[model samples]
Target: MSQETVNYLVNLLIGVILAGVLSQYWRLEASGQSLRLWIIAAWTLAAADLFFVARSMLPPDTLPRLIPTITVTCGHALLLLAAQQTAQRPQQRRVICLIVASHLLLLLLLRAVPAMQGWRAPTNSVVWGSLSLAAALVLWRAADHVRPLMRFPAMVMAFQAFFHATRSLLATQAAVDANPVRSAAVQMLGDVEVSLFMVALFVGVLVAYLRQSNDDLRRALANVQQLSSMLPLCAWCNKVRDDDGYWRRIEEYLSEHKVSVTHSMCESCATKHFDEFKP
Candidate 1:
């Protein structure tokens, strides 16, 4: 209907796509079963968001009362999973599972009582703040345990949480007064918030993963390669020595490195050494 509404719809669809894509990516590259489960959890949250948008036949307050409860619940669940179980440490994973159960219990309580809607309003802020903090803590939580590349996804989550939290707070404020222009502005803002955060989080993690992969491939390649100039060898003795060690012949080391060689001898060496006939 309105430009704000259209933008909101567009952003919602785009965010869903991004979340699904990112989830799939995580599912594919994730090292552990728990990590893949978390990615699926994230996809679940994104699906809830889509459901919220689809069921918005009623007013915003009423629609949010259902879908957002599921969305926020799934979101926190997914984030906790990602934070603690990406690398699948059993102890941390247990803690994460506890946190998830606790958060969902809170959501269940809120759903049973409409008065808890106020509490739901602060959810985005709390979850985002928590996400940002959790990601930061991951820096120290298992810094010695996790790879730097593994940290990228958490950082992306942190940014996503902050954006969603701010958007939710602003949208709540906009909902209170029933101001037309402010409501429109809030809708526009939500679009921007959701779209950009999805892009940043998904694309950021993907790029980081690809870069890490490239670096690993390069390192693996470097291990077997030598960039140095060839060393002098004793032609008569058929010995080849590198900076590291002496080899019986050039063919020995070359075989390991996928190099092929053809045997050749000068006419003098061929006749003198092999035939033992000198002019």
Candidate 2:
């Protein structure tokens, strides 16, 4: 198959995989909403990839080039949002608005001015790199709260940012014109880098989810153990004082805590209460 055909098929497959993963996560009620944001990010990235695949199939200028650029920009923005959500950080509306507006302005410039077309690659690189770096920074700041495995995701984002920044520096028209072979090599390298980054991102998200689930399970077990421990009980009444300072009968307390108890009388209690019938 031709290179274009291969690229289209690969991107299509990636999109399908992302959609499947999103659907799987959607059905999981226990994953929580924040966790699902990662799946959303994946879907957005897949959409961007599909746009690229479509571009390969159609003739140049058949579709607005700006469409793919906007889609990719939105995908990167979603990645940053997902990272922020994962870190449990508050999303700053002002910052998000500014980023979106800047992207829109860039898109307008690209569409209106012929001269600005040459700068498109570098401009997109910078924007995408900045988003990736922001995600890395957010994840890094949340390192203390999350599991050690979270560092992998942060590192992956940082690597991606660095790669894009490097590309921006090397993607000049003069540089490409000077050495076509070198330019082609660099482009191929970027494709590989992006593929690797996607795999790392997916794996990191899965690891994060598993770690979160494990932590939740641990907390639940600790709560159960605490309830099973010694309680402050009245010596005569056999009533327990709970965390709220309310005294309740043992049966009532256990029932409230969702513990099942079988009612039974001890031998001494039975004999003392029924002396006439005692053996």
- The alpha-carbon deviation from the true structure for residue 29 of candidate 2, after best TM-score superposition, in angstroms, is 5.0
> Candidate 2 local accuracy as lDDT?
0.74
Residues 212-279 of candidate 1: C-alpha lDDT, one tens digit per residue: 66776686576455624555677787677766776667777565555677788998888788785545
Per-model TM-score, in order, reads 0.58, 0.75
Please, what are the lDDT tens digits per residue for candidate 2 over residues 1-279?
A: 567446546765765685576558557744554666677777777776677766666665443556667777787788788788778788765786688679878767775776555566667778989999998998888746673656888899999999999888876753546656756665666656656777788777776766777877897686698687999989999999988999999898877666788888998888888877856
Which 10-residue span in candidate 2 carries the lowest summed lDDT?
56-65
Separately for all candidates shown, the number of backbone clashes (residues 3 or more apart, or on different chains) is 0, 0
